[model samples]
Structure formats: structure tokens, C-alpha cells
Target: MSLQPIDSTQRIQSLDVIRGFSLLGIFIVNMIAFHSPMYYYDPYSWWGDSINRPVYWWIDVFVQASFYPIFAMMFGAGLAIQYMRAEEKKAHFTSFASRRLAILLGIGLIHAFLIWSGDILITYAVAGFILIWMLKLSGKMLLILGFIIYFLPQSLLSGIMFFASMVDPTTVTYFSSVQDIESSVANYGSGSFADIFGQRVDDWTYANSPAGFISIIIAILPLMMIGAGVAKTKLFEKASDKKLLLSLSALIFLGLGIAIKTSPYWGEKNLAFVFTQDYVGGPLVAMGYMTLLLLIMTAPLSAKLLQPLAKTGRMALTNYLLQSIIGTIIFYNYGFGLYGEVTLMTGTLIALGIFVMQVIFSELWLSKFKQGPAERLWRKLSYSKK
Candidate 1:
């Protein structure tokens, strides 16, 4: 097996740190689903009390759609790195990449069905297949196409929603079936393991139905392209070379992201506005967060402070799966049976607590080994058994 480099003092990449940071935000947002049937309920309408309402509002504006983009970009960049390594080694890119993604798909399948339904690994693995073909595109071309492909559909959809809201907002579907929430609570909160599995299938289907998936593709694929482009261009270094410019750009993106993301609250709070918030605003915020983090990490003291995240990020896939495992065990009937019982605040606390443990776990794990357990398994499976 490949080992961690012989030199132990090499600086970790900022990308890994960002990946680790994204996990906390992802878990925080996912905590909503872990504790409640958030998919079936209208977030705008739920969280009735004083405590939950503000909690939801904070998450929606800052954390909800924001961090996933960072994660997606990281995934894309990491794949680009792998592609580069393959090219350097004169390896057959196609067969190798396919096998790797296939392994990911298998892992995702187990995670989605056996553990939890809110799985992005499956989607990423599938997207990796598409990205493999697109890797030949130049960084500039990738960026151009990524922006166009992503924004064109997203803009059109947002426009349609906005116009529809203006016409009659009630027709827009924010929440799914009333029965969905009830069944989810019954199965996940109190029923047997089999019951939770059944509900997992339903939840996965509800989110990934053909029509719904088109939206996911446009959102995910373009970001992947942009991320790959960034990696290919080495843009992070160039952009970061000038702290003043990077800071200004980061502020602008953050300001704009906040403004656009809050449209649902400030202007309409309707389905159309919600779409804009998730699709458009989320990426902007992600860019801002990334730049800002890059800047912070470039500084000596702050970088040292945040180094634990790099350790966690190096083991990101493992931590992500572990999160699902922990979350399921905490919420599912076969485990703690706390589903539908924990509040938003409580779930946030749980996420924070878990992530802290993961940071420590990652540090400890990496000290003695090269990769996290899952990542080691993935690498081993992707290559020769010998």
C-alpha cells in the first residue's frame, strides 16, 4: 500500500483544509434532516417556536446551500489532481477512473440504502463518470462552459419561478406530501431497522426522481467543471498572490451572496425566490467563503490554528461516511431512536460535537497511517491487489 510521504513536515494544501471546513457546515445543514423529516416539510413554515425559527433562519441564510458548493468544488479539484497524476504516470485514465468511480458508487449504494438516504456520494460518483470525459477541456474552456451550463438552466428556472410567484405563488410546491412526514417519523423514529430501510428508499426516491434530478445535475456538474478548471489553472495561487485583490473580491461575493440568498425573506419568501437562493446565491457565498478561508490560512497563526481541519479533510470521505453512520445510529429506531425528537438547536450541537471528535479522530488516525480507513479501502480497491 502507498504510504504517507517519508517527509512528515510538508505543508498541507489549503484545499484539504477547506474540505474539512465544509464538512461541519454540511453536517449542520444535514442535521435538519437527521432529526426531522425536513425534506417533507416546508422550512419556511416549520420551526414554529422562538428558538427553532431563528435557528432555521441562521442556517438558511449562511449555512444551508452554502457549504455543499465548496464540497463539490473540492471533489472536482481532487479529481483533477488524480487526473493529472494519471497523465504524469502514463496510466490509462479511462479504465482507472471508471473503476474508481464504480467503487465510489458501490460505497454510496451501501451508505444510501443501509445507513442513510441523504447521500451525495452516489451523485458524485455518477458525476465523476461525466467529469472523466470532460477532463480534456482546458481550464478556461471548462470555466466558460461550466458557468454557461449551470447559470443558463438555473436562471431560466429561477425566472420561471419568479414569474409564477408573481402570477400565483400558492401553486409552487415547497413541501412534499403530508403523508411523507408522518411515514418518515413513524418508520425512522420508532419502527424496526427494516422500517427505516423502507423509509430510506422512499426518501431517496423522493429526492432523486427523474424530474428533480435534472436540477441536481445542472447545479452539480457545472460546479465540478469550475472547480476542475480552477485546479487546472492553478488559480488559487495566482488569486491569492495578491491579498488586497482577493480580499476585495471575497467581500463582494459575500455581500452579493447574502443579498441574493435573502431574497426569499426580503422580497417573496416564495418558491421562486427559494430557487434563486439555493441555486444562484449559494455558489457566490461558497466562492466568498473559499477566498476568505484561503486568505486566513495564508497567515501563519491562523493557518496553525486551522491545521486540524486539514487532517480531517485529508480523510474527508471517511469522515463524511462516518457522519452518516453516527447520525443514523443517533436518530434511527435501531440506535438511539431520537429521530423527530431533537430540535434544530440540539441537532446543531450534536453536529458540532461530532465534528470535533472527527477532527481529533482524523489527527490520531493520520499520525499512524497514510489515509483514513475508508479512503485506504477505496485506494486499495481502485488499484492492483498486489
Candidate 2:
């Protein structure tokens, strides 16, 4: 029999910190998307456009490019860790991972149906099955595959954008309306906090179908696979390695991301349609942000920020769903009904406040409990009460 490696149960502090941090960071970007219509983009109402702007912009820049990638990278790391644990225990990986993924799917379904349409768990669950296969490949192979998958969608999107730019330079499929955008945001924001009954069926269908939510999974699988590769290599375990790579990631991915965001040519429309989609530059930049966190994790000072984040990470599923619930209560017409009314600046503050509260809540919650509420439930279900 092959020798099992070191203790698999040991928790990695850096991973937890990065996870928790990403939880906070993701909301900065997700809030804009969440509060508005799914299709339209309006700066004034979406993120804020006025004198209180610098703060919003600061949040936008810092949080927009930072969190999602870290989450994705951690997903990869988590997958690798699970695989290692399975191997160490001489268990069936596919069966075990599939069970976990299925539970995640169920949780995601509840989130999308009852909470928010912008939920990401379903995508993670779907892509997870495919990611398991890539786990055994070499790091070099996985990295190459990651880039290939990452750009494949972008390649198709770029082709479409190029043709559109040439054929109908005036045509814009995204961000063309303010009123429609408001209507869309209002539709969700104006309803009862949990009154997604009418929309839930449609949203759930869209979320599960290939052209909708599933596309997101296809688009992101590459990054997740790359994350698994990184975990396999023990890259996160070495501070020096993370520092060097993080610097490179900043220069390459972050530089490109900033340039893309600022360029007049890209605009909000392209940013949403061309850049943020499956076949766009957004995920590429996410990769860079992942590196940034690794570098941050290497610094001992980072422990403060990362510790809470790690706790959040440890209970990511619960926290993610909780975000939707919290957002619903605060913004929905049936609840606090702030909706399209909150200024970008105000929303940003609220988001930060909620994040801080969650950190405290999560830390306290975890201290008394072995696993997150949702995580524990998931394990219980997966184990079939064995």
C-alpha cells in the first residue's frame, strides 16, 4: 500500500483567512449586481455617481478584482484537500466528492429559489464534478489546461465582440437603459423578502440550464482546476513561493485588469457583456487576485485580516447564503425595503458593516460549533446519518 502523507485533518490558517477575506470582498462587487436588474447597468444607482464617489470607487477598485478569484482559488484548494483526504483514507473519491457536490447543489437550489438569483454555489457544485477528473494531472498540465479553459470562452466572446464592433457599432446588448435597469432592480427589491415564488421557477430553470447559470460553471472550471493544481504542489504552504508569485500576478493580471476597467473602449457595457461573461477577461483578472491573497497570507500581519476571513471561509456555504438573506431583509420591499433607494456610498458602508458583523458572528458561531450550520447539515446529509 502507498504511504499516506502527513495528517490531513490539520487546518491551514492562511486558507481560512483568505476564504473569510474573500467573503467580505465579494460583496463589494456582488452588491452592485445584486441590487440592480440582472441585465442593465447604471452607475448612479448601481454603485453611486456623486460627490461621495471616491469612497465607492475605492471600494470598487479594491473589492471588485479581489474577492471572487480568491474564492475560486480556495475552491481549488478545498478540492485538492478533499482528494488528499480521500486518498489517505483509501476511500472512493468520485463517490465521496459527488455526494458533497450534490449537497451543495441542494443548498444552492434553496439559495436561488428562496434568496437571491445571483447565487454562485450551483455553479461550483456543477463544475466540481468535472474538476475531480483534472485533480490527478500534473501541475504543469493543470496550469496549461487552466489557461486554455479560461480563454476559450473569452475567445468566443472576443470574436463576437469583434464582429459586432464591425457590423453594428451602434448596437449594445448591455447597459443600454436606466429605466429598464431600475425596473429590474425594483422587481426583485420590491417583493417580499422570500416572495420569489413567481420568479423562482424561472430563475431556477435559468440557473440550472446550460445557457444560463451552467455556463458560469463551464467558464470557471479552468480556474478551479488550476487551484487544485496549486494545492497539490503545496504552493500555499510556502510563504516565499506565494510572495514571488503574488508579485508576478499583480504585475501581469492586475495590471491588465485595471487597464481593461479604465479603458474608454471597454466601458460599462463591454465590462458587463464582454468582460464579465464566461468568455471574457474577468476571470483572468480573478487569477491575479488569487495570487495577491497568497502574498498577503504570507505576511504575519495579515493574520488579523485573514483569521476572520478564514472563519468565514470555513463556513463559506452558510455565509454565502446568509448574505442573500441579509440583503433581502435590508433591501426587499416587504422587509426594510431600501431597494433602489440606497446610495452607492451608503450601500458600500452597509455592505462593510454587514461584513464586519458576519465576521464576528462567524467567529463566535464557529468557536462554539465544530462546523458551520450549513456545513454540518451538509455533512450529515451526505453521510446519510451513518
User: lDDT of all the models against the reference?
Assistant: 0.85, 0.69
Over 203-275, each residue of candidate 1 has an lDDT whose tens digit, in order, gives 9998999977766866898899988988888766565476887699799989999999888888866678888
lDDT of 2 by residue, 64-89 (tens): 54467668778977888878877777
Q: How close is each model in CA RMSD to the real structure? A: 2.3, 3.7
Q: Top model by lDDT, which number?
A: 1
- Residue pair clashes in candidate 1: none
Question: What's each prediction's TM-score?
Answer: 0.95, 0.85
Cα error of candidate 2 at position 254, Å: 1.8
Error of 2 at 199 (Å): 3.4
Alpha-carbon runs more than 4 Å astray in model 1: 1-12, 173-176
In model 2, what are the clashing residue pairs, if there are any?
A: 16-310, 17-306, 17-310, 20-309, 21-309, 153-279, 154-279
lDDT of 1: 0.85
